[model samples]
Target: MSSFCPNCPDQTIVDPPQTVYENYYHPQHVQVIHPVEIIRQHHCVPVYHHCVTYTVKDKMCTVSGLKKKSRKRK
Candidate 1:
């Protein structure tokens, strides 16, 4: 039902059998998220290890979900 690809802002939407009801996405824009370890480097020295979660959109170099932070009053 979308006119454009969810993963690609400039690309038009494509109706793939797997995504009939969902927003369309280009074949190149569809990808599987993979897990990996991230190492923080400080001038060639490893400072720390960073863990992260990847979504399908992220794996395809597209924007994923949106998160909002609540502020506390002093």
Candidate 2:
């Protein structure tokens, strides 16, 4: 895939993984799918202190689709 990360396995991390991961949020075992974008807040770049954002829903993460959803006994 075009977005596959060179560092990680194929069809794993999203193509063009987040670049600001290491530079900004230093998280262990960081996986990225989509590239980081400069979001404009109030006509300026939003301030991201030190943390990465990846929405979790439907037992899958938006960025990295590899993350499994919560396993609950039926």
Q: Name the best candidate (by TM-score).
A: 1
Please give, for residues 1-74, the per-residue lDDT of candidate 1 as tens digits. 76985575565776756634667766666678999999987686668989998866434454569566689999
Clashing pairs in 1: none
* Weakest lDDT window of 10 consecutive positions for candidate 1: 55-64
**Per-model TM values vs. the true structure:** 0.14, 0.12
24, model 2: CA deviation in Å? Answer: 74
Candidate 1, TM-score vs. the true structure?
0.14
Once model 1 is optimally superposed onto the true structure by TM-score, how far is the C-alpha of residue 59 displaced, in angstroms?
74
What C-alpha lDDT, on a 0 to 100 scale, does residue 48 get in candidate 2? Answer: 75
Clashes counted in candidate 2 amount to 3
Once fitted onto the true fold, the runs of candidate 1 whose alpha carbons sit more than 4 angstroms away are 1-33, 44-74
RMSD of 1: 46.9
